[model samples]
Target: MVLMQAEKTAIGSICFLAGPFTLLENALVLGVIAATATLRRRPTYLFIASIALADVFASCFFTTSFLDFHLFRQSDGPTAYLFKLGGVTMAFTSSVGSLLLTALDRYLCIHQASSYKVLLTRRRALLCLLILWSVTIFISFLPLMGWRCPTGLIPPCSRLFPYVNHGYLACWTSFTLVLLTLILCAYALILLKAHRHETSMTSLQGAAGTGHARMRMDIRLARTFGLILLILVGCWLPALSFMLADVFVILTHTQQRAFAFCSTLCLVNSAVNPLLYALRCRELRVALLQLLQRLCVIGRCKKTTQDLPPGIHFTEEISCTAITEHEIPTNGTMQLHSVSEMVNN
Candidate 1:
């Protein structure tokens, strides 16, 4: 029993520490996107703003679960119910759903261009956002309303009763599998279309420098898109696979770890998008640098204002000090001069 408790404690601690990195990464992404927009003269990222909010809500579960188990010395005190109901269920689930929406948005933007704007307009995105949040909240609230039981347990705090394991994993698994299959098929078709266009260009131009250059550009773009697809698959597959396995075979302790790891990986994946964008897209990188500098300047100004002495009379003596240091003298003495004060040392 003691050993088991210790193991849980250790795992929980690791989880809490690792989870915050997701927040930091997301925050950086938000900064980068906003900075890029201002520097490049584009609009700010309303999408990133939503994502940042969701990630923060998700942390209520990610951070608290770990701290309750590993950080707090108290074995029991204000946990389980509050954290699971308010934190884990609401925050984490909404975050995951937001990710699904994000993936679908990107997929549509790349593959189904003709209807993209019409279907994925501001109104549509907002509607989708509302629906996703509503669903998550409703699902999480089912237990409290006595419609369904909870799912799991934290030591001496909250416990989740397995309600419908078959539907639990099967539903999400089937939904994801179907959606991903369609997404991949669409991407494949899009690639084929791009290739055909390139071929016609090549035929017309006889593979000149411009045609060759376009071909290379096409290949690089395809590679970048492919990377994003692979990341989505690699991060989510483990958890989905475990959910499937749980339906047929027993989910051993090892499998539990794998599922949990997958969940964590997906969370980290949300934070990774901006980094990948910056690395694969040059424009993104430049924008990111600008945002960082802007934020730094803003931060510096705020700090300076906060630190300013009281009543310096806004326009005191305005003297500019230009300090110059002469090269060390032959005798190993240093020379310093201030232009404004005309002082020598």
Candidate 2:
């Protein structure tokens, strides 16, 4: 139950270092999406933006509360502790939900290319996000709403005991496991469908060029999804398994330390998500670069916008025009330009 001084320092140091980096990475993803009007209108980017926003909160709340509880040992009331954990729970739950929605978006893009846009309109995407966050908030705060540990018996409750309810943890763990399984199945079907398309194209005469292009897109998407699955399983499965175990058996000190490490690994996923989903897209990369460049220009120029150099104005105009002129490639039945261009068409 108690971590050694060295163990505490080690875990705290990792959280301290990784927390800001995670926050900054996700924040940049959000900034790029917000700055790019073209990306803002699509359901895909909206899901991605939702993930980044949740990660931003996750990084902030988890790092602060974790350090407070484990390292600093802040003397806080039960209500305050529950609030911190609820925030962490809500943020992480929303993140996982958004990821599931993103996978569904990709599935529709591949399987229902013709009606992907109609199926997932921007308004509908926003509504899904609203409902996801609403449900996540309610579920996360159940412990605070009279679901805490019963009036203390002998040995205290498990890991998140006395603050978070065991039943809630079990249910949440089951939900996460279900989400991971669904994501795996979704990607499996996508790959299978792509394989069928490739085989059909190869057998057909005069459709090689277009079919090959679409196949290449599918393969690239498969690779990206593979990486995502790898990370998700690597980062989450251990912690989730541990939590599930904790629900049944009281974990030893060593197991507790391992769980702590696993929890930190989960935070690493938040940092890497932008790389897998956002920066991999050429459009988002360009937008991020332009956003950084604009920030640099603004930092260097002390004068007002009207007093800026004409060349800077010209550069801005050209960048704007370039972004506006960029077109989604529509070849065969697939109209994807990049990994994150699912709903852009």
lDDT (0 to 1) per candidate: 0.56, 0.81
Model 2 clash pairs are none
C-alpha RMSD of candidate 2:
11.1
lDDT of 2 by residue, 192-289 (tens): 88888777776775574876687787778678778889998899999999989988888787898888888998888888888887888898998888
RMSD of each: 8.3, 11.1
lDDT of 1: 0.56
Query: Which residues of candidate 2, in runs, are more than 4 Å off?
Result: 151-156, 206-221, 296-345
State candidate 1's TM-score: 0.65
Candidate 1 lDDT by residue in tens digits, 58-111: 655656654454345335322344335445556655655555565566666656
Error of 2 at 33 (Å): 1.3
